[model samples]
Target: MMRHLLPLLALLAAPAFAKPDADTRAWLARTAELSSDAMEGRDAGSPGHARAIDLVERWFKDARLQPAGEDGSFRQTVPLHEVAVTSAEMRVVAPDGSAVPLKFLHDITPRPATDLPATLGGAMRFAGYCSAKEIGAEAGPALQGKIAVCFGSRRTGRANGAERLAAVTAAGAIALLTIDDVGFLVEPPRWPDAYARSVAHDGVTLPSGLPQFRVNGAALATLIAGSGRLAAAILTDAGLHRDLESFDLPGRFEAKLTTSQRKFTSQQLIGLLPGTDPAKAGEYLLLGAHIDGYGFGEPVNGDALYNGTLDDAAYVALISQLAARRKGKGFARPLLFAAWTAEEKGLLGARWWLQHPTVPKDQLAGVINLDQLRPLFPLKALTLHGLGQNTLADTAKAVAEGLKIGIRPDLEPERNLIRRVDSWPFMEAGIPAVNFIFAFNPRSQEERLYRDWYVRRYHRPQDDMTTPMDLDAAQDFNRFFYLLVETAAHAPETPRLSPKPGT
Candidate 1:
């Protein structure tokens, strides 16, 4: 009789476990809606982006979230200026005074300054990998008043492109040129079309008036041949060692760029769910995701739309789901949900918020940013950006443990991912923040899937509604996220940045 009753109980519970919860279903539907073709990839300042914003606003209203933006509105405007190259001509002048014409988008890609002059010319100087220390010491004077040429990719600890450009221009360099070396598993590099469309904040001026160009290896080799320095030898040395020697090359390169400019504005959507506890409600927990992606661009596989389903739309959907889940029953701390814009345009929206926050910056407890959450594998582990930087990591660890999910460190820390997402601006503003990514073991099927998705779908039209997803993994992670927020909200104290030892 006991065995018969056990079988009957198992049969009775089957239906409860058969279907996904209402929240998970709603999340998936919202993701599909956002990634639909009608959204036009949700590019900033575009009609499709406007529709996307309206959709999010509707979701917020339906969830009964309070407007937390400027003037009790849900929109925060971000002014932006866009510059695109209309025409370009470049030549490498040999030591013998012969000129070799370089082709655009093939041999080299020109990145004109936002406010460029009608015509420009300079003698090219090879500054090797222009590290900050090198620029401050030897390369600074050497790069003065010339077109500074340097390696595009650098090893860890070196100044990135923006930093290198700032240092070079401050050193009085007239222009900048970067040569691309072949990277691991990314051969015959495909230059990004974004160089043709440069966007920047309208009020923020660049460090210099230098026009920059990223030349292909073959083109750089052509220029290096005249300098009596073999390109292969330089590349081999740079590849073998972390640091390389800087020197003055033997050529004068000239480039002229014609550009067209336009000014436009995009908006960041913000909403608030007030906490049940008024004392803790004063300090808010920020949750955010970028709602923009590359608009229509060069078509791949007969598709021009970059739907960005997993690139960001999925996470934005998660935001809506969370808002709806806690609508009537609020947490202990208020929740601030922000759908950021112009993230692909250099994190402008987040930076703008840092400059103009809805509430006082100190009133913020911490931030959890979501972007490009592709749930293609099981939820065994998660990679938390800025993991050990603050007390939030402790909360996250506890929550993940309760859910039986492992918390892992960023595997590709060399990518500088912490500074690459929406959380960076908050971190720079002295706010505690963290970003999440699904984790996979080294060289496993999960790793292979992640690599394949990045190579094929990331920033491409292939990341559309049709892309396969692991729904169970997504639901599990969503559950963990919901619980994590509740745990943080009810904690005795707001999350704070952890001080380094001996500080």
Candidate 2:
């Protein structure tokens, strides 16, 4: 009787262990609240988004996180502009003076450079992938006063459309054309009406006096007919051998673009956890997640709102949870929690933060970004984007390994996942940054689930609260992320950008 009584007393004296189900249920509750119809998809600058801001601010306040924004508030305002092509006309002239008229949305899509309408024309030049190294020294003179054409894909490395446009525009090109294969469409299927909406971004002037168009295979064939090289042959060679050869086309191109513009403001929510060490507190680690989604768009299956549950709402909740868990805990360096706006609009909010950081830019040690993480399968492995690009990879690997989770490099580099998230802005600003995704073995059912999610739910209305989820997997990942953040914040030395040699 005495021995049994002692055992019971020992159990009672120990601290209560948190049940896994309870934690998962709490997280799901938050996700459901954020993804509910009442949020209206949390579109940036909309009343729904305003409600989201209020909700997150309340959460931060509840967690007792110190306000890190200007004027001792939890909000930072970002000024932006929306640019869209209202109407566009294009004509490709052959050497024989035969003109081919291209239809909008069917043959090509015009991405306006500014809000102004103008007509521009020039001789055509096929610049392959328009890679800076491929273009070489003579490209400046050759591309001048010409419409430079190239393949629009990740085969050109980090230089995507906007980057390529900036390069050619700087080289004096009057216009740019990119050939995109239908198989590489990034967004979900949409009707012609979707093109009527403009894209938003920070109000930065475009690099050059050139407009860019993303044309399909049909339009490419028409533009390259007079060049003696078949568009099909060029595309086939590039696809098969992954090599592109630049050449001069024996024709000219003309475009008349009309655009409309609107200016508006959005807010990024920021909170801080000051470090215990005064010396290291000035230096900070940034953790970020985008809070905006496609407000209301083309409906699918009788649903219209894109709640973005897995896309980012979960991670934002994770940030709030961490702040609550770590309250009053001592740390070497400060932890900055940021909920960015307009990530779907081309990483605009993150970019704005880089330009106008809440903390001094130089003191920023590293950034950990969370975007579009889906845990549909068991958490056996983790995918770390920008792995080996910095010392942070080592820290992430160590934490994952301790938890018996394998760490893998980005498997789908062709998707340009590294540049697509909020971390990219910090990386571009010369700071070490990393983003995460769940990993699965090759040819496994988990892989199938991952692929199916992208096809059926990514950027779609189907990504709402009603979608089936693996809350256990989500809870496990949240634990891993929390450990990773704590490790980085308390490390003796902050993570730095130290790329592997020859990378």
Best model per lDDT: 1
Error of 1 at 177 (Å): 1.2
Best by TM-score: 1
lDDT of every model, 2 decimals: 0.79, 0.76
Deviation (Å) of 74 in candidate 1: 1.6
Worst 10 residues of 1 by lDDT: 3-12
What are the runs in model 2 whose C-alpha is more than 4 Å off?
Answer: 1-20, 87-107, 115-150, 156-175, 182-203, 216-238, 242-258, 277-279, 298-304, 326-332, 497-503
lDDT of 1: 0.79
> By summed lDDT, which 10 consecutive residues of candidate 2 come out lowest?
185-194
Write out the backbone clash pairs for model 1. Answer: none
| Tens digits of lDDT, candidate 1, 13-55 | 4454346667776787788788788888988888989999999
- Tens-digit lDDT string for candidate 2 (1-503): 23223432342233432244555556666666666667788877888888888888888888778898878898999888777677888888887888999887657777765634478788888877776765665576788888898776654353576677777877778778887743353322232222534555555764235666777666777887766788778777655546677778877887787777778888889998888888797779988998887777756676667778777787787787788777646468888899899888888888887778777889989888888689888889988976788888789989999999899988777677888999987888778888888888878999888878887888777776545556557778888998999898889887888855886
Scored by Cα lDDT, where does model 2 land?
0.76
Candidate 1, TM-score vs. the true structure?
A: 0.84
TM-score of each: 0.84, 0.76
